[model samples]
Target chain A: MKGIAKKIQASEVETLRLRLTEAEEALQAIAKGSVDALVVGGPRGPVVSTLAGAQEPYRLVVERMHEGALTLGEDRRILYSNRHFAHLLGYPVAHLVGKPVANFVAPEDAARLADLLDHGAKQPASRELKFRRRDGSATPALVGVGSLTLDQTPALLLIITDLTAQKHSEELAAAERFARSILEQATEAVVVCNADGRITKASFAAERLLDKPLEGKLLADAVPMEVELPAEAHHSGVRMSSREVLELVLERHSLRGAEAQICLPRLHEKHFLLSAGPLSDEPGGCIGCIFTLTEITDRKRAETQQTMLVAELNHRVKNILAIVQSVAWQTLSANHSPSEFKRAFDGRLRALSLAHDILTQGRWGHVDFEQLVERSLAPYHGGDHGMRAQWSGSRLSLPPNMVVPLSMVLHELSTNAAKYGAFSVEHGRVNIAWRSDGVNVLFTWTETNGPPVKGEIKAGFGSKLISRVVSYDLLGTADLDFDREGFRCALTFPVPKLRTDALRPLSAAPSPVH
Target chain B: MKKNAEDLSGYNLRLYIAGQTPKSIAALSNLRGLCEKYLSGRYRLDVVDVMADPALAQRDEIIAIPTLVRCVPEPIKRIIGDLGNSDRVLTRLGIDVSAKV
Candidate 1:
C-alpha cells in the first residue's frame, strides 16, 4: 500500500508540472491573441479549482497571427494546434492533432510545401510561406517558426499573417505604372494646366514647340498673347478703351480671322502655321488653350503662284482683245463702199465687244455658252419683239480658252440669221439648244420664218472665223445647214476644257448678262 | 387721386444719403428741420454715406449731387435740388397741406 501511494504521488507531481506549464501557455496565448473570451477557468487539477495566481511565461516567443497556427514536426504530422488552426483547416483540434499536414494541402502545392518545410526545419529562422487551404484556395501568409519543447519533445510553433491584400496592392501599383508609361510616351502633345493659368504639366512635344524648357512657368507669361480673362467678359456692357476691342477679338478668335495668319517663328529655318482652340470644361468658361502647328508654307506659296498666273492670264486676254479690235479695223478698211465699210466695221466691233463682255463676266476664267448666244442674238431681236429667241436643254459654260471660239461661232450664226434667215423678215424666230452628252457639249442653233432662201455666193470673214475657231482652236466639229424654212448650225466640243479642275473654270450655273 | 391727410401717419420717408459732400450734406440738412416738423415720425429717414467709395456712386449711377430719390410714396419719385424751400418740395411731393398734425 505504501509503494502504490508513492507511485501515485509521483504521477501527481508530473501532472502538476504539466498543469503549471499549460496554465502559463494559456495565459501567454490569451495575451497575444485577439480572440474574445468570456470565461477564464484555471487549470483543472484532479478536482476543479479556481486560482487567481496565473503565471505568464517569461522569455517566451508569442507570435501575432491571422488565419491559423501550424505545429509541423518530424514525419510531416501535425503535432499540436490551437482552436484557430483547426478552424482554419475546416477540422476539429481533436481530429487534427496527429493528422498528416499533406491532408490539407493540394497535391501540387503539397510536394512543394513538404520540401519547403523540410528545408525550413533544418534552418532556425522564420519566413513567409504560401499554404493551400482545405477548400482548394491558396493562402499567402507570413509564417514564423521556432524550436520549442512540448511534452518534452522538440516541435515547431508557426504563426502566420495573411499577405493577400498586400499582394493585391503590389499588382495594382504595377498596373498604374504601366498606364503612366503609356500616357507619358503618347505621340500627341498633352498639357495640363490649373485654374490659375499655370502650366503644371507638359508632354515631350511641348519641348519641340517651345524650343526651350518651360517647367514651372505661368502659361500667360510663357506664351505671348495668352490672356487670362476671356474676351467676352470684357465686351459684356463694359466700355473699354480703343485697342481693347481689337485685343479682345483677336484673343477670342485666336488664330482664326480674316487674313489673320498665326506664324510660328521659323524653327531650324522652317515655318509652320499655328492653329489653336480653347479647352472648355463648362459653358461660357474658357479653361485653357491647346495649339497645334501645321506646316503650310508650301500651300501658301502655291496659292500665291496661282493668283499671279490668273493675273497673267487676264493680261493675255486683254492682248487678244486688242488683236480682235485691229482685225475689225482691217476688215472695215478692206470694204469697197463707205456704207458697206461702216456696216462691216460696226458689226465686227460689236461682236468683239460682246465677246469681251462675256470674258469680263467670267473674270477671265470661263464664260457660259448661253450668255454668249444671248449676247450675239440681242441686236437681231431689235427690242425683244422683232426676232424671237428661245433657249432649251442643259446650261453649259465653257472655259475662257473655249469662250473666244464659242463666241465667234454664235456671232456667225446670228449674222447669217440677220442677213438671210430669221431677222430678214419682220416676224421670225431663232431657237438655241445646248446639253452635255458624256464628256462633250452639244449646241444646236435653228432659225425660222425668214425671207426666201438664197445661200451666200462667197463665205464672209465671220464665217471663216467661226470655222477656224470651232474646227482648229477648240478641237470641235461645226456644221451650217440652210433649210428652206430657216438656217441651222450644230456644234460639239469636249467638256474637259470647261471643267473647273482646268484652273477655276466659271461655275456651271448661268448668270444673266445684266 | 385721393390725397392722404398731412397727419404724422401718412408721410413715411426714408432717404439713403452718402458722405458729407456739397450735394449730400446740402441734401441732408436742407430738408431736416422743415420735413421733420412737417412729416414727423411718419417720415423715417435712412442715410447711407458713400463718398469714401466712388464705386457706390457708380452702383447707383449717381452723377449730380443733392439728388433726392423718394422712397415711401408709391411709384417712388425723385428730385435734384438743395432743400432750400419747404413749400416747393412739399408741393412736388404732393404732401397734404390741410392736416399738418
Candidate 2:
C-alpha cells in the first residue's frame, strides 16, 4: 500500500488527472483516502472521446499487479488465477482459476508443501521446493508464497521453474564415471575390435604379448607373425576356416625338432605361453581375436622333467623285479635249501645292486655294457684265469628306460651261465654282441665251454620276467636257446627306443674306468 | 588433520553410524572441527547432524553419526562420524557425490 501511495504521489498531473475519477472510486473501497486525486493525460479531445467510446466495454489493462492475486479461497479451493500467476506454474489462466492447486502437486511432495506452508506463514520468503504438475509428475521449483490481496480478497501465489533435466544429467554423469573406472580396472584383458578384424582397443597385457603396437592390425595376419607354427599341421575345422592355422602354430612353436619342447616363447628375457581365440560380434560377424599370454616356461620345463623321471623310475622298478626273479630261480634249480638259497640269492642281488649304483651314478642314460658284464660275472669267475667275458659292437648312449631292463636281462643270463651253463667249468667264455638293424636293435649273449648243456623243459620266473619286459615294456622280441655246449639268448627292440643318438665304435678292450 | 578429505574436488562422503543418538553429537561436534578443516575455505556443509536435521538426514539418506555434507564438491556427499574414516571419505568425495554408493 505504501508503494502504491508513493507511485501515486510521484505521478505527474498530466499522467493521472483524467483517470482520477475511476481511481478515486476503486481506492475509496480499499484505502479510502489513499489516492488524493486521479488523472489521465495523453492525446487530445478526439482521442479521449474515441477512448471514452471504447471504455465501457474495453478490457482494463491492469499494470504493475505485483501482488498475490491468485486465490485459494476459504474452502481451500483455487477460485481465481490472473495471467501473471497462472503463467508462473505453467497453467493456462482459464484452466487453473477454479481447480485446487493441491491436485497438481505430487502426493509425496504434499507433506513437504505442508511443512513449507507452515514455515511460510511464520517467515514468508522465497524457497526451493518441488511443484506438482498437471501430468502427475513433480518438478523441482522455486516457489514464493506470500500474503496479498486480489481486488481486496486475500490470496496466495506460487512461482516455479522445472529443475529435472539439470539434476538428471548430473546423476547420469556420475554413473558414467563409475562405470568407466570399473572397466579400466578389470582383471581380464579386454579388447575392442571392428567388423574388419582390426583392433580398436587393447589392454596393457596385449601390448606386452604382441610385442608391437596392434591398435589397428588384422587379427588373422597378426597371429602367424607372432609364433612359429608346425609344417604338418592341418586345421581340423575346430574353430577357424583355414587348416593352415594348425601348421602355423606347429611351425611357430618348434614342436617338430627332437630337441624342441612345446612351451612358451621368450619375451623380454622372460617366457610366455600364448593362446588366441576369435571374438565374434553379437549380430553375426568376426570382429577380431582375443589373445591370452601367460608366463609358463618354468612350469613346462618342470613338468617335462618330472614326466621323464617318473618313466625312468617305473622302468627301473620292473628291471629290479626281473633280477630278483632270476636269483630265486637259479637257487631253486641248484637244489639249495631255503637258507642256502637266501644266501646265494642275496649275493646275486648285491651284484645287481652294484651294477645299479654304477648306472645311477651315470644318471642312468647308459652304462658300459662290457664293464657291466665284467662286474656281474667277476664274483663267480674269481681266480679262474681261463674264464673270459667279451663285449663287441658299437657303444651308444641308451635312453634310461631301455638301459635298466637290458642290464637286468644280461645280469640274469650271466648268473645262469655261471651256475649251470658255460661258466660252471674253468674253460668258459661268454661273448655279448649288439648291433642296430635299421629300426630294430639286436643284442646276443653267446656262451661256450661249460658242462655240456642239455635241454631243460622248465620255464622259470627269470625267463618269464625277461619275456614280460621284452614284450610289454620294451615292445620287442626275444629268444633263448639251450644247446649241448652252452646257452644263448637274443633280444630285439625298436632302435630309436633304445639309443638316443647314432652308435659309435666301441673300444675292443674293456675300458678300465668302470 | 586437514587431509585428502578437504582436498577432494567433489562431495563424496559416507556416514557409518550405529543409529540415531548423541555420541553422534560428539561426531558432529568434531566435524565442526573440520569447519576450519574444509569450510574455513570454500565448502558448504549440509550438516546432517542426525538429530534436529533428521529429515534432511533422510534426504541425504544417512544412517550414521554426526555426518558432514560436502555440498560444493558436487552431487552432495555425506561423511559419517568417527572422523578416523577420513581416507575413504576423501576418495568418495573425489568422485561425484551422485554416484552409486
TM-score of chain B of each: 0.70, 0.48
Indicate the residue-level lDDT of A308 in model 2.
Answer: 65
Model 1 misplaced regions, further than 4 Å: A1-314, A329-334, A382-387, A496-514, B1-101
Predicted candidate 2 versus true structure: per-residue lDDT over B13-38, tens digit per residue:
33322222223323333343443344
lDDT of 1: 0.56
* CA-lDDT, candidates in order: 0.56, 0.51
DockQ of the candidate models in sequence: 0.00, 0.01
How would the docking of model 2 be graded? incorrect
Q: Please report, as a residue range, the 10-residue window in candidate 2 chain A with the lowest summed lDDT.
A: A505-514
Positional deviation of residue A414's Cα in model 1 after best superposition, in angstroms: 1.4
Error of 2 at A167 (Å): 2.3
Best by TM-score: 1
